[model samples]
Target: HTGNEWGTENRAELCFPQLFNTSCKKPTTPLSQVLLFHILMPSMSLLTVTLNLLVIIAVSHFRQLHTPTNILLLSLAAADFLIGLLFMPGEILRNTVCWFLGQLTCSLYNYISFVVTSASVGDMVLISVDRYVAICDPLHYPTRITERRVKVCVCLCWLCSVFYCYMIVRDDLSQPGKHNSCFGECIIFVEFIAGFVDLVLSFIIPVTVIVFLYMRVFVVAVSQARAMRSQVTAVTLQLSVTLTAKKSELKAARTLGVLVLVFLICFCPYYIVSLFGDEFLNSASASIVFYFFLLNSCLNPLIYAMFYPWFRKAVKLIMTLQILNASTYK
Candidate 1:
């Protein structure tokens, strides 16, 4: 028996140390021990979750802020919010003890996990596609990215995610006492299908499109950089030649490139681990990695606030309005 068979199959059944004892077999406890780790992990999760909720509610309540891009952001917030609320808390509970809830709760947990995860993946893909259109086809973007089209796209994304998760949830529900065992295993085929879909839809498709789009973006950037450099060089030939345009364009391109690169760097490891089924096969590391991926949701709002001018302004405006309203009432 594994050292961590302390929980129900449908829920986690052990504490963090017990669950991960095997992974840290060589380690001796430090002064603080696992206490610090536990506190920090849950705190981070809560912080990210609360911020995401604030952003989502703030955006939803403001009609002037709604747009095609914001719609995708709202969808992403919804997915991330559910992930933090429904999934993470249950997982934490499971890890610390036996499954307090029965099969019904277990099924709901699994279903919500599947749905939110799928939706998050779909939102990433949509954002990538949206960026490609905005950057590559600026002139036609207004016509292509209609509000109705975005709504349809968001709806389809949810539908596909729900349908994808349904099979797994249904399969689990079909077999009574199937999850009664002391493991989190679902039907093997269901696991297989979920894994395959995750690989294809989340890892494979999004990465492919993002890579291709960024490649084009780079080429265009280089071409534009060269043109600017050439013009600067010509002017410099007549003057001191100290000032440069190539360097500035290069800086902007590099900044955008780095942002995209950071996203991939942060996310790629989890997906790579995901591709190997064994990583998540009743392993405690899977839970940790799952939370690591969820960190991206928190990172998303930061990304938008930093990189997207409109989002930054919107956030600022909302905050300003709230402060004024509070002051006025006071």
Candidate 2:
């Protein structure tokens, strides 16, 4: 029982003064850390929620934006929104104060965390597959990746995530507080095998699929670019239109490649720590990795804002409160 079993503390203050003998010491969170948790976390949460909500509104409100690819963005935005709305605040609450939310709430928090995370990962994989089809097999993409099929895949992704993560956290969900060693703590302890399986299914394999598909996509995209460039002098109006369309697809693959890259940068360390035994599971470095993982949700919408003109237009309409009166963004 390193000090971590009690949430990053090996200090003097008792978490529960009433049960002096059994109570763990509360961690002395620094003023900077407190300010960070108090000020920055809420701001991050609000920004995440607000930006992702704009994505949702933009994609859903504008019928012109309802392509299969945007549908996947909508799903990813939904998961990021939940992460901001629920998960970030939960971490802030548990860290800055006592776990007054109770055991059932904690279990639910962890459960939803897993579900949202798995779904986010699934969305990334789906996005990769979508891009792969769009770039590698462009002629068939329209028929292959219809809005209906995207919707079905989104639904199945969520269902499978729900079922799979349930198997991982079912014990804690049932027992409620089985993982907590003392009061004022909300701990998540998954079995080694389960954690490894999660690392493989949720992190490793999906990442492998995303990387591989995106690699093939980029290679094909680059080839398309070279072909278009070589044929630039002989371009007819129709060929120009065709070239422009291909360039659009290439740009999309580039943007989503950035998204997947950011997701990997954020998620890799967390799973890397998990790849180690339980000894490193609750360490301070692991805590940092966990925070890094959570930051991905906040950063995602920012990437959308940077890359997507529609996201910018939507944010403008949303901020001006004109979205209510608008018919479509375009």
Predicted model with the maximum lDDT: 2
| Candidate 2, poorest ten consecutive residues by summed lDDT | 3-12
The weakest ten consecutive residues by lDDT in model 1 span 20-29
**TM-score to true structure, per model:** 0.71, 0.92
For the record, the alpha-carbon RMSD of candidate 1 to the native fold, in angstroms, is 8.4
Give RMSD to native, each candidate: 8.4, 4.6
The per-residue C-alpha lDDT of model 1 at residue 202 equals: 65
Full-model lDDT for every candidate? 0.62, 0.87
Per-candidate clashes come to 3, 0
Q: Candidate 1 at residue 313, lDDT?
A: 58
lDDT of 1 by residue, 191-287 (tens): 6666677677666887788788778767766676565666654544633332233343344345445545655776787777766674363346555
